[model samples]
Target: MKISAVRGVKDILPEEVWKWQFIESASRRIMENFGFSEIRIPVFEYTELFARSIGQGTDIVEKEMYTFQDSKGESLSLRPEGTAGVVRACIDHHRLQPDSVSKLYYTGPMFRHERPQKGRYRQFYQIGAEVFGTDNPWVDAEILSMLHLLFEQLGISGTVLQINSLGCTECRPVYRKALQKFLRNEQASLCTDCRRRTAGNPLRVLDCKRPDCKEATQSAPSVLASLCRDCMAHFEMVKGTLDLMGVPYEVNERLVRGLDYYTRTTFEILTDQLGSQNAVAAGGRYDGLVEQLGGRPTPAIGFALGMERLAALLPEETNHSRAKPLYLAPLGDAAMERMPLLLHQLRARGIPVDTDYLGKSLKSQMRQADRIGAAYVGILGEDELNDGVILLRNMETKAQTKVPLEGFVDQIAETLAGEGA
Candidate 1:
C-alpha cells in the first residue's frame, strides 16, 4: 500500500521555504513600522464563534469550514478566516476599551474545504491586521497605504487597488431590501446557491463566481447608490485621503467581499499575473463586528493576504543573500578531536559555522561543504592542529590562507566584519 499527501495540501520544501521567509520578514517589518503589534489566536475555536461573526449565510460558514465535534461533544472548527477570530479575542480580552485604539496583526494557517487551483489551497497561510476602537477614515487609509507599501517593497508590480463603500448600518438595510427585490425579479436566471443567498445574504450574491449569477447581478442595485448621509461622508473622506497620498484606485460597486462582517470602505489589491485567483490581498472595515462579539460598539478596519500567493508572485531569485555558515573540515582523527572546541570558539564570536560528524574523507567533506554553499571552508589537519594553525579556503574563489589558531577567532571576526569574507 502507498500513502500520499492529502488531496489539496502541499509541503514547502527547503528550496521553496526561503521565499516564505522573505515574505514573512517583510510583512513583520512593515507592520512594525505602522505601529501594529502581533496577536496569535488558536488554530481551532468553538463553532459558534464563526457562525455568529462571519454570518451563518456566508459561503465560508455554510460550505468551506472544517468543523467537527470534540470528545466532550462540543463543536470546534479550524479557522476559515482571520477577522472573526480576532474579533473574538478582542471581546474576550476587553481590548476595546472606551477611548483607545488597538492595532494588531496575526499570521497563521487557515483551513477551507474547497477545490484547489494553482494559487489556491485547502489549507493556506494568511497575514492579517486589524485595528479596533476608531471610526476615523484616516485609519482606513493608513491600512491601505501599509498594504501598498508592502507590495512596493517586495518589487511586486502590476497590482491595482479596487475600492468600494458598503455603507454602514444606517444604509445597508435599505440597500438589502432593494437588492432582494431586484434578485426576486431575476430568480429564475440565478444559480441555486445564489437563490439561497438572495434569501440569506443578498449582498453575497453580487460576489458569486457562477457565470449565470454574475450576469444576473450585473444590473442589481449597487450599495453605493443607497449610501446614507453618514456613510457617504465617511466614504468621501477615505477616498480623499487616498488621493492625497497618490494611491491609485477604482470605485468598484460590485465588489462585495466573501466574508459577511465587513462594512464601509472595502478594498482589494489585484494583479493580473495570477490567472483566475488574481486577488493578492483584500480587506475592509467592520464597524459592527466588535459589538456583535459582545464588546462595546467599536469601529475596526483591516486586511489579509495569502502568503502562498504573495510568494508565488515574488521573483524566483529575490532572497539569495541570507547569511550561511563558514564550513570547518577536519581531515584526520587527531584534528577531529579538536573540531568541537574550534566550532565553539567560532560560534561564541557570533559566526555561523558547521562541521560534519560522520567520519568522511577530506574530499567528501569538501564536496558536502560546497553543496551546502558554505562561504568559506576551514581545513584542519594533524600538522595544522599540532602547529596551532588552520587553513582557510574561500569557496567562491578557491583561494587559501593559513592562520595561527591562537588568535583565529578574532582574525576571522575582523575579516568578516570588514567584508573580506
Candidate 2:
C-alpha cells in the first residue's frame, strides 16, 4: 500500500495556506485589540483533566479523544478542545491569585477522532478566547460584541447570533428531569446516542446532530422556560447590554451548544453558508468550572470558532494578499556574480525579490518568472552589466526603464512604493 496521510488528518497545501493566514492574522489583531493575552498550552495533558472538566459522559471524553497510556503507565490525551487545557494551565499557575483576572486567547490544532467532512476534521484548528474571574453580564456582552466585530472585519455578514439561558445549578436539574421524562416517550424514535444520553446527560439530547434525535427533541422542555429568578435576571442583563450596543440577536430555545460545561447563557452564531454544521462560533457562561477544576471560585465565559467552517464561508476572491516579488534574470558571468549581493540587499531593505538560480537560458528564465507571477522582472545582460545599469520591466504594463546599478536599489524601492506595492 502507498503511504499517505492518516485517514482523518490533512495537509494544508501551499495554495490554501493564504486563507488560513488571513484568518490567523485577523484573529490576533482583533483579540489583542480587546486585551486577551495569547496563551499556549500543551497539546497533550493527563486524560483525567478532560474527563473531570469536560465531563466523563460527554462524547468528547467518551469517544473522540486520542488517548493513550504512556510507558510510565500514565494516561494522556491530545486535547479535543482549547478550554479544558487553558483552565488546567490557569489553575496550575495560580492565575486566580490576589484579585487577578486572566483574559486569554489561543489558536492551534485540536485533536479528535471523527469522520471528516467539509468543515470537520480529526485534527482541526480553533481560535478560542476566555475571560476568567468575573461573572458580570457586561463581560458577556463585551465578548459577544468582540466576536461580532471579528466576523464583520472578515466581511462575513448575515450570521445570526442565537442566545439562550441554560439556567444554573439551582434549576438545571429540574429541567434535566423534565427533558428526560419528555424524551422517554419518544425514546424509540431517538438515535442511539440520544437514547444512551437520555438518563445521565439528557440535556445533551437537545444538542444531538442526528435528524431523528433533533425531531424527537423538538417539543422537549427548554431550560429557558425553567430559568430561576437570578438566572432570569442575569440573562436579561446580557440581552439588555447587547441591545444597548445595537447587537442584533434572537432568543433561540434550541441553541444548546455541544458542551457539558456551559451554564446560564449559551449561544451559537450560525450561517446557512455551510449547510448542517453551520455554527461558526459558540460558547457560554460556566461559573462553577474554575472551582470544579481546583482553582478558586471563579466565573468565566468565552467562545471557540471553527476555523475550517469559517474559512469555508469566506468569499472566494476578496482581499487575499500576495507577495509581489521582483524576479531577476541575470544573463552573463558578471551579472550572475552580482546577483546574490543584489538579492541580499533587496531582502534586507524589505523588498520582495527572487532570481533564477538554476542557470536556465534567457527564454527559460523569463518563462519561469512569468509562471511564478512576478510583478516585475529585472533583466541584466552584457551591455547593461558593462554600463552598470539594468532593464527593469513591469510585467503588467510591459514598460521597461534603464535603471543605474549604483542607484538601482533605491530607484526600484521608490518605484514599487509609488505603485502601492
Candidate 3:
C-alpha cells in the first residue's frame, strides 16, 4: 500500500526546520520586547466559539474550518485562526480581570480545509499577537510600529502597509447597504463565493480576490466614505500616530480583510513577491468581540504573519544556517566505549553534540560531519586514551587541538563560545 500524507498537509523536515526555528526565536524576542507574553491554547475549541467571534457569515466558518463531532457527540472544530482561541482563553481564565490588560502572542499550526496554492496551505503556520483592554488609536499605532520593527529585523523589505477604517456599529450598516446595493448591480460579475457573501456579508465582497469581482467593484463605495465621526477620528489618530512614529502606510480604501470581527481600524502587510496570496499579515480592531463572547466590553487589535508567504520572500541565507552540532567520531574500540559518556555529559550542559552510531570509519564520519556542517569534530582514539586527552578539530578552519580529557567538555565549550558557535 502506498500510503502518504493527506492532501494539503506538509511535513517540515529536519533539513528545512532551521528557518522555522529562526522565525520562532525572532517572534519571541520581538513579542517580549513589546511587553507581550506567550499564550498557548488548544488546537481545537467548541465550534460555536469561532462561529460567534468570526460571525456565521464569513468564509472561515462557512467552509474552511475543520469541524467534526467528538465521540460523545459534541461539536468541535480545529481552530482556523488564533484570535478566537486567545480571547476565549482570556475570558475563561479571567486574564482580563477588572482594570487589567493582557498582551499576549502565540505561534502555532492552524488548520483549514480550503484549496492549497502558492503561499497558501490548508495547514499553515502563523505567529500572531494581541493587545486587550485599550481602545486608544495609539494602541493600533503601537502594534503597527512593532510589526514594522519585526519586518526590519527579519530582513523583509518592500512590503506595503495598507490601512482602512471599517467604521463601527453605528455607521457600518449604512456602508453595508451601500455595498449591498453596488454588489447587487454587479452581481452577474462576482465569483460564486462573492455572490454568496453578498447576501450574508456584503462587506466581504470587498475582500474578494477574484479578478472579475475586483474589476466589477472597482468603483464600489468605500468603507472609509461611510466611517462615522468617531471611527473617522479613530482612523485619523491611528494614521497620525503612525506618521509620528515614522511608520509608512497607504490608505487602501478597498482593503476589507477576510474576517468578520474587524472594526474601526484594519490594516494588512502585503507584498508582490507572492502571486495572488499577497497578504503576509492582516488584523484590525475587534472592540465588541470580547463582550459578545460573554466578557466585559474590551477593545483589541492584532496581526498574524503567514509563515509560508514570508518564507517565499526570505533570503536563502536563513535556511539551514543554524550553528551546527559538534560531531564526535570514535576512531577505535576504546574511543567507542567512552563515546556515550562524553556525549551525554556534553548534552547535559546544553551543547549540541552528536556521535557516530554506525561505527563508521574516521573518513566516513568526517563526511557525515561535513554533510551536516558541524562546527567542530572531536576525535577519541588510542593516542588520546593513553595520554588522557582527545583531539578536537575546527571543521571550518581545519585547526586541531589536543586537550586534556580531565576538563574536555569545558575546554570545548570555551572554544565554541569564542567562535560564537
Q: What does the lDDT come to for candidate 1?
A: 0.89
**Least accurate 10 contiguous residues by lDDT in model 1:** 316-325
Model 3 weakest 10-residue run by lDDT: 314-323
Which pairs of residues collide in model 2? none
Candidate 3 vs. true structure, TM-score: 0.91
- Screening candidate 3 with a backbone cut-off below 3 angstroms (N, C-alpha, C), the clashing residue pairs are none
Question: Which candidate gets the maximum lDDT versus the true structure?
Answer: 1
**What lDDT tens digits, residue by residue, belong to model 3 across residues 1-421?**
9999888989888766777777778879988999999998999999999999998877799999999999999999999999999999999988887667789999999999989888888899999999999889999999999989988877889899999989888999899998899899998999998899898878778777788998999999888878899998999999999999999999988888777888889999999889888899899999889999998888888888998887677777654455688999898787899988898899988889888887899999999999888988988888989989888898888999998999998988888788775
The TM-score obtained by model 1 is 0.94
What lDDT would each prediction earn against the true structure?
A: 0.89, 0.88, 0.89
Model 1 spans > 4 angstroms off = 191-193, 208-218
| Residue-by-residue lDDT tens digits, candidate 1, 1-421 | 7999998889999888888888888999999999999999998999999999888877788899999999999999999989889889888887789989989999999999999998999999999999999989999889999998999888788889999999888899889999999999999999998898798878888888899999878888879889998999899999999899988788888888877788999999998888999899999999998888788999999999999999989987575565757888987788889888889999999898999899788899999998888988888998788788989888888999998988889988887778744
Residue 108, model 3, lDDT: 95
Give candidate 2 misplaced runs (Cα > 4 Å): 185-193, 207-219
